[model samples]
Target: MYAYQCIYLADVYLCEAGKLLVVPMDGSHWFTMRSVVEKLIERGHELVVVMPEVSWQLGQSLNCTVKSYKTSYTLEDIDRAMKDFAGTHWTVRDDNMVSLWMGSGYNFFELVFSHCRSLFNDKKLVEYLKESSFDAVFVEPFDMCGLIVAKYLSLPSVVFTRAVFCHYLREATQCPNPLSYVPLNFVSSSDVMTFKERVWNHITHFQERLFCHHFFKSVLDFASEVFPEPVTLYDLFSHTSIWLIRTDFVFDYPKPVMPNMVYVGGINCHGGKPLSKATKPGSRTQHGYDPLT
Candidate 1:
């Protein structure tokens, strides 16, 4: 395989009017990615977004070719899942590590598996995608279907995400995130941790390592049918060309970065807006940018 360039998810320089295929995750994740899609459109990039018909935030007023596919899930299933997910923030209880560690994880996985299975079942779409001759794929890690598609098409996959789940980032990118200093996500500890916190970090990290395969089992089963060779999420991810993380140093602690990983964090953040009478003073500063004098 030819070496891939480290680039932004949106602004990859290509032949004029380069074609891009997008496989986006639903809900708030789409909100972050939509700005990138619009900017690409503004730059005259032809984009085709393939998404399930039953989605909360997709199918909006974006000027792109949106190809919808049927899924086993319905709108109500999505809403109910979202409702339960959001409802967790308000309903308080004792800290159950098992419950808190995997809040809404199974629900999200179930939906993703359903979509992945249905997407492949639509044999025509799969065949069309193979024939599209697209340049690259933009995908978030939460949805495994996009990765599967990239593998199927032999296209270079660009991952646009905050972080891969369960510390798969380390395995996939070969980037070192030391257990002692780099606190595992979901544990919520900073780079520096107390002895007890460090111990808890190890515990949490170990659990995810053990259970990660279980989380990915359903989708991997679909992958087995599609490919002659055995595959796993790790195999799909190891082929990623660019990793466009949605965080900057302002939002994330300093850590070791790999060559192919780019932090286009706050790339979605808009630039300065003119201050009017309605604009509160220093509001821009509060939002991480200084307002002009």
Candidate 2:
């Protein structure tokens, strides 16, 4: 086994060289997963990326084999959703917050699912994957379609989420999530929570879990109709080889993580040239800071 180390990216262990099929959710997600794909390619692993046509620039820059699919929703739909959410009058009240969250969730889901549906219907994409003898599949965990494709191809799958924490992936991996101390994503709470805050966290966590469960269930049912195999979404997720979460203690609060759940946070951070002594504060050169003595 070979282990590579870096200051920003997580330490990855590779036992052998093989081709990896990368499936990114959308343009934004393609940008997030770009570094990972690039690292794999640098390690002499072949890569095949499947992404939305909106990310054609990214695919072209990667200089790898790519299969781009068209989506029904346009960039305008995304802009509208952002405008609606940002334009809303936000408040601390439960009703107002809940309304905003749910509305945004629905709009985002519609946009994502529309793309997923289009990817499923692309016979050429499906045929390409069927013919490509990929060793494993690397999927962004935004949609279940990638998991379904992995199942259809009988390949081991790994999930890489750009978020600090993904509740669905955590739950699927049976990781310990003590809601009492672990705050929900966007809940604006520290590791230690007050009694009332813990209660609120529990309620919000439960609500999100319930909503996502049903949402994925519907997606799974629709996928089942199109794919020849009859596997539930839960099965596909539960069997995932690893869940790569983008997080690090440098910025994130402490939390429990399972063995399979690896934190690759700060993987995007890159180093630059050091500050020259001439440019340093209290130096004599131009742009240098002057002492107040």
Q: Against the true structure, whose TM-score is highest?
A: 1
Please write out the lDDT profile of model 1 over residues 78-166, one tens digit for every residue.
77776776666565342333464247746855775678778888889888888888889988877688898889899988888877877
lDDT of 2 at 208: 74
Which pairs clash in model 2? 247-265
Could you give candidate 2's per-residue lDDT for residues 1-293 as a string of tens digits?
01223344357643556778887765566666888888888887778988776533347678678888887777777767656755553533444345654576556666666676787789988898889888788887666767767777878788887662236666677878888888877588888999999998988787776666565655777677776776565666775777787766557666777888777877767865564457555566534434554
Q: Candidate 2: misplaced stretches above 4 Å?
A: 1-16, 54-58, 75-97, 164-166, 214-218, 227-233, 278-293
Report lDDT per candidate: 0.78, 0.70
Candidate 1, lDDT over the whole model: 0.78
Q: Alpha carbon lDDT of residue 278, candidate 2?
A: 71
- Candidate 1 residue pairs in backbone clash: none
What's the TM-score of every candidate structure?
A: 0.83, 0.78
Error of model 2, residue 59, in angstroms:
1.8
